[model samples]
Target: MQVLLDTLAPADAPRVADPRALTDEDLLALYAPPQQTWLRVNMVSTVDGSATGDSGLSGSINNPADGRVFATLRRLADVVVVGAGTAKAEGYSPTDTPIVLVSRKAQVPESLRGAPAGSVLMATCSLSDGIGEARELLGEEHVLTYGSHRVDLPALKAGLAERGWGHILCEGGPHLLRDLVFQGAADELTATTVPRLVAGSYPRITVGAPLDAHLTLRLLLEDEGTLLGRWFV
Candidate 1:
């Protein structure tokens, strides 16, 4: 991918990238969190703004370039926070990086459960009777509760940060992203616009309430008609 725009670069030196040589390490330099406790979201959408396809998974809209950035960001993140719905829809599971599954129902899919205690965490509330069962099925450290009525995103994030997981990478399923916005937890967003268009009932990349957020386009790159962009939110 080549750089099309880079507002994050110094004013004196305009940004430029050589598609022939650009690497994931280079992308990491441009996207690494600048602060200790930070949140960055990564997502891909179609030209028609559909965040997913009939299968309710964004993997169908992804490409090689997007895959590289996805892997790189996870490598740099202290923890990966994902909506439980997306985790189930996308067949998410534990990997080398730690993951915090956010859910109110305590309905963590079977796939994400039974992972190493050091690798997975489930954030839910007291109302969900499945919490104890999930903890037993997974592990004790695998569950955490925030609010009785709802998941307190700020407190959830703080608890993670206190555990030395400061740089947060949120892989949204829309509602979780919306919650992050409502709680003012997101700091950056990296989105990839796929070349294809799908005119379907699927919602746009963001389905949250209209709340004005001040953001600047920090970087933009493209390859094979796929637009990769980042913003400071």
Candidate 2:
């Protein structure tokens, strides 16, 4: 990818190599988390601020450039965190890395029902009716309950850290991203803006009560009109 700006690199240095010429290793080096225990969110949106295309899924909005970065982030993370809604909507399956599904409901999504043992986990609430089902599907040890009514994001992060899964990546579906930011549980955001205009009723990258958080842009890259930005929250 072409480096539009990199705060860590000297301005006098040469610009980035060609985007088309970059390999998977090059992308990994570019997106590697600077800290060991970091929480970063990866999201894609249209120029018109729609998080999804007509299909109403994030996959519909992403391009090949975003796909490279997406895979790189997943490969770099110790655990992949995603909301149950996104997991279901995107037809998520077990990845090489562990996946933690955050849900208000206690039942596991069908897409992840056959996931390998210990490869997937459910972060739900004790109040949810299907806690037993969740526990039965993913062993009791894998089902983490934090809050009474909802999955407490901070506590979930702490719990993951305790398990030595510190390099965290959250693949969001808006509401989960909003909760992470609102609860001060997110460390950074890596957003890819696709060069399209899908002006419909789709939500923004984050959806919830109005938030007023300032983020510092640490890196910016562009490839084929798609802009990838890394912002520290």
Candidate 3:
């Protein structure tokens, strides 16, 4: 990865200024948040501002550099908060790191049926119907419920923090990202711009109801036509 713009130091001397290439370890360390209770969002979008490409997935549009950053971000996170739609669409499997699936209905998709117990969690509303299923498949401690009929984003964050999973990472499926922003739970965002034009009615990074979450640019990187950026929310 190449540093294009960074606000860490003056324009002349960037704090991450490197004469040699950065190793994967160094890169992951640099992406880590300042505090434990930080929430970071990771997303990829095409040049035309669409989140999906011809394959109806971001992977079709994202390049190798984006994949590398994606892996690094996952390593830095304590818990990966994802939506069931994305978990299934992306064919997510259990990893060494825990995965928190946020849903209103608490439905555990079939794709996650093979996941080892306690490796995956379900974050849902109190009135959700799949509590018993989730608790049986994933351990009881892994099934977290907050609001009565709607998933409380803030409460979910707090619950994760209480369990020492403070470094929250959200790999959204649009609507979940919108809810995170609307609930003011997101602390930072990493958006990689793949220089491909996929002009269609595909969703952007954020969807659902409107939100007013503010963000400030922190770092900018480039690899050929791809631009990787990080912003503080």
Best by lDDT: 2
lDDT of all predictions: 0.83, 0.89, 0.85
Model 3: per-residue Cα lDDT over 20-117, one tens digit each: 35568757756878787999889999888999987888888889989889999988889999998899899888889999999887878788876887
For residues 1-233, write the lDDT of model 1, one tens digit per residue. Answer: 77777777787764335534577777777676778999888989998899887777898778898998898889889999998888998899888889888888877787876676768788998787778876786677668899887788989989989999999999997888777877888888889998998787987767777767777887888888998888888
TM-scores of all predicted structures: 0.91, 0.93, 0.93
The alpha-carbon lDDT assigned to residue 40 of candidate 3 equals 84
Q: Which 10-residue window in model 1 sums to the lowest lDDT?
A: 13-22
Name every residue pair that clashes in candidate 2.
none
Per-residue CA lDDT of model 2 for 1-233, tens digit only, reads: 67777785556763345544567776777777887789999999999999999999988899998998898998899999999989988899998899999998976889899789999999998898888988899998999998999789999998998899999999997999999999999999999999999887998999988999899998888888999999999
TM-score of candidate 2 versus the correct structure, residues matched by position: 0.93
User: In model 3, what lDDT does residue 142 have?
Assistant: 81
Q: Which residue pairs come into collision in candidate 3?
A: none
